[model samples]
Target: MTPAPGGFTDETFAAFLKGRDEPSWLADRRRSAFGRFKATPLPTLRDEEWRRTDLRALKLDQFAPPAPAEPSEAARAALEPAYRGLDSLYGTGIALVDGHAARSPDPSKLGGAVFVDLASAVQEHGELLKDLLMTEAFRDDADAFAALHAACWTGGALLYVPKGVKVETPLFHLVGLSAEGGADLSHTLVVLEEGAEATLVQETIGLDRGKAPGLHVGGVELILRRGSRLRFVNIQNWDTSTWHLSRERAVVGPDAALQWTVGGLGSRLAKVNQEVALVGRGARAQVNGVMFPTGRQNLTYITRQDHVAPNTTSDLLYKGGLKDRSRLVWRGMIKVEPDAQHTDAYQKNDNLVLDADARADSIPGLEIEANEVRCTHGATAGPVDPEMVFYARSRGVDEATATRLIVEGFFANVYDRISVEPVREALALAVAQKLELGSAPTLASAEAAGV
Candidate 1:
């Protein structure tokens, strides 16, 4: 079957995949995902998840697939106008400029590691990719954007650590969106064999500071072999006018643990699907997510903790704050299969509303087929405690100051889960700055001092 004019087609996408030298299995999967993308209509309000998000004005047809690495000086300069010093903890650094990996920075000085751009690796490491790329081990479902990403992704990163290797430093990947009427499709695959441990940092940003609106669609798959550990953080600070969608999931082998933290502070409309399956006994998964929305922006976050094996545990905590006319919806679920005995799962979603005009929705559910399993799910959506705000204002704090205090306290729960102190401080300062609460000199000093 063919896609609509100007829309992506399986034939074109399949040809592109074949040109990348990908294995026949991956190419076939891309074709199948493309067919699904063509058959499944664009989500509208009629759908449960898309009810709060309006995509009519997005005009996704205008975005052309990104070209190969031939960026103009202007585009190159847009990459890093003010160089952010490289992190000493992350040995390898990769930059996805426009929609391709611009250059391969040296990462050999570090320990045993494999880091390469997806497009480049397709040509250089086709065999290894076929054996370790996006497998059905991660998740079996894909939405529209995920299907599109599978079909048309041009750039991303791949990191692999062999067994018995420990990476002290994280792997840093930067995905940049710079061109107008262009789409950024990136696919990140991280694999850690048994006895391997590593951390990954993913940053998505827009080079266009103007009002131009573009599309960022990405898919990531994480595989953790037995006795491995992985920590992943997604720092999304794109242009406020952009529309972004991402689908990421992980598969845990026996005795493996995965920790994920996400901070969403940009984009006019965003949808994120984060899930993980505990396929092995004693596997653990934890997720801590925080989002603050202002203006007319709207954000949707969905998370799933599926236990297919016995004695697995998963915990999730997601917090959100909305001001102005913005809105946010958070839906989470924890499912235990029939034979998954002794599985423990917990899910909680809390939202603090700062403005009367703003809105927040929370839906938390659980499905347990085993009688001996332990599962609990809860959701809370409401305004800040009026008594607490009044007490602060009664002690000489202005209305705005008191309001910011309440908001900060609301976010403290999720921010504390992040082990990286510098990023946490930076995020807190950024959140305060966005709320226009710069009057709090203490916040600036704390952030500057990296306390």
Candidate 2:
């Protein structure tokens, strides 16, 4: 069997599994996932979850799983431009090029935490990953992209904190792609045991302009044990040529809390599913998102907050801005089970359309089986209030500066919820840079904006 050049065929999968000298347990898991991947069909317009997205533009056959990651000086330098001020802000960090680790986590700052690439974790800490790897966050009958990610995922990380450990300093990860038409399948697993606490921040860098048609199928699993705490932030900043598809899920335990934030600033098209399950009493979760799409880009994010136990609370907010002919879609749901009494849940999504041709869709829903639960959801999408722009412009701010100020204030709602100063500042800076919204307070001629 040999690998395919244009697609992931049976021969390619078989050859891939054979080349890796993995233990039987991991090999068997991959094989099982491969079977599932073969059975599940690719997403299409007919699928309700994918109905709003433009499926016709995605040419899945054009991307092929990339070869194993190898060291490259150019790759390292290419990644440096993104995620500025990372070294001083994070206690430990990992830089990956095409899924392979270019820099591993620092030993000194781990503070007895186990931070290693998934492959190494499989070899050195097999006991820790035995039953907790993919079982907690994913199921056997997952979507095609998720199943394929489980089968072909190559370079990712696993962070495991022992009971009673507290890693006060934030950890960092950078994911980058260097080759055009290449596919990267990376998986992240984070586990915090009883009474443990940690924070993780992840960012992605895609192939530069003139680089086109890349693919990313990724997965993330966060498992929190009793009385634990975790704060996670992920910023997807791939170039406009990349098609990003990912499935992320987290399970919260008794008395635990999880704060998850996301920033969607790049990618030609991105569809993501993020879910958090509160399965234990007194569990809590907060989700925040900031998304901006421009230049014909399309971005979609779906989130679910499931409360399965009594006395659980969840709050979610997602804000997006669109320009050019770009489009943004956000759907959120909060579900409370019959036994989840005293559950409190809320979700809201808002979008600002900066161009007449640009479009935005926001949908919020609730499914509650508990009589005692309180759940509320709301969604709003419209162009920037001419009144707000006018107000800002009245205050010595030119039109460009006024619009920029309005956009920043709109997104600041979520930024204020981020608690971590560095993460908040970095995200704000990146958004300003990507949108070219940072400049002197000139008149910002409509002609300059291609009006």
Candidate 3:
């Protein structure tokens, strides 16, 4: 009902709001965010965070907010291994079709947890939503995308686990976008109270690929209270023609532990910002990332680890592979506040380029104001080792198979750090499929690589 020519203009923004059925508070928030979006300009190559990234070809006006979509079996079927085996891993799940929620868990199955679409949470859990949504974990109008997402986001999910509730089964959020799903502006908010524990898996799939180009501007906020533990895995697998942009942040509280894993393998151009803030003593975070880009795609990740409390610890590892004309970029930082003494942080990013035309860029940094902190970072980018391929070929594997095997070995380390069996399998199988391998990586290859 909205999103005409000049998709993001003030006129279209007002039209978008006119079509939504939201409350006064939400309307006010949208207006404020749109105001900020108008005041802020889109990132350019001149900005520090975007110096290596360019958006000169992106025309936001060409994309419209996705209209509510009907679930299609054909679309789901097209996702193959990425969407496969999901039903067996979760006790309950939320499915979003073309930026609209298709199904939600029965409230009784939540076991005292609140897993519902953000649209409903705004009414059923307004007070808590008001206090936490965009207030704690990812609060900022840093750029145009952030503000635009806050202003026009829809078809998102919220998971709020009560204090002391330990959900043994992982929860799933799956999104399927089709050719007709013009634009996806979804926000995911996950909140775990004190002593609570849960696992949440978020996945995005491009159903009916090679249709019209698409756009996704997404946000994710993870909030863990004291002593809580959370495991979150994000799978981003949109079509190569889509423009994918996202911001994600996690706030870890005292004695809480967070494990975040990511799989990025799709999109024409992606620019993501991921950050973690340790706000309490004894807090810990372990982050793992795996990215494989093929074709002419461009992928970039900007990550930060913020130590805000004493005795906080953080560890991060990211692995990437580039093929064809694809390019990958990683810029990472570890920041230790003056008050956060005894902080321990480490970050590393490694990339493998498989083609002469492909490129990879890795940049790691540290900003420490604390005298008693240990922060370290490392990065590496290069073509695959020729000797490894030669060895594989000497062992009777074909050159192509050998290359795939070596690439598998390259990602084995990060995969080992992932605790979820299904997630690990899905990411591995998805990446393998992208490399033209079958459903699962070869066991011989796994053993040869010592995975």
User: Highest lDDT among the candidates is held by which one?
Assistant: 3
lDDT of model 3, residue 444: 19
Root-mean-square deviation of each candidate, in angstroms? Answer: 3.9, 4.7, 3.7
Better of 1 and 2 by lDDT: 2
User: Among all windows of ten consecutive residues in candidate 1, which has the lowest summed lDDT?
Assistant: 437-446
Q: Model 1, which residues run further than 4 Å from truth? A: 1-5, 9-29, 81-83, 86-91, 103-105, 137-141, 437-451
User: lDDT by residue for model 2 over 1-451, one digit each (tens)?
Assistant: 0124758778778777776767888888888888888899888889989988876877767765556536367766666644334655677777777767777888889888998888788888887788898989865456888888888888888999999999978998778887532777888999999999999988776744355567889899999999999999888877777889999999999999999999888888999999999999999999999888888889999899999999999999998888888889998889999999999999999998889999998888889898997898899988889998888888888988888888888898899999766777766766665467421110111112222
How does model 1 score by TM-score? 0.90
Residue pairs with clashing backbones, model 3: none
Per-residue C-alpha lDDT of model 1 across residues 1-451, encoded as one tens digit per residue = 0112354554455445545655666677777777777776888889887787788888866564554435566665666531133333345577776676655657773378788888778777888888877665433245677767777777899888899788887667777777543577888899899989988777777775487667788788889899999988777667777788888888998899998888777777898888888998999988888777888888888888989999999989888877888889888889899878999899988888888999998988888889999898898999888898799988999888898888888889788988766556766776776678321112213356444
Candidate 3 per-residue lDDT, tens place, 1-451, comes to 2235667877778877887777788889989998998899899999999987889988888876554334465654543333334544567777776666666776666788999988778878888888888988765498999999988888789999999998888888887667666788888999999999999888876766575777899999999999999999987877777899999999999999999998888888999999999999999999999998988889999999999999999999999988888889999999999999999999999998888999999989999999998888999988878998899888899998988888888999999999987777667776777677322232112222334
- Where does model 2 exceed 4 Å of error? 1-4, 69-71, 80-84, 437-451
lDDT of 3: 0.83
Q: Which 10-residue window in model 3 sums to the lowest lDDT?
A: 438-447
Distance from true position, residue 53, model 2, in Å? 1.5
TM-score of each candidate?
0.90, 0.93, 0.93
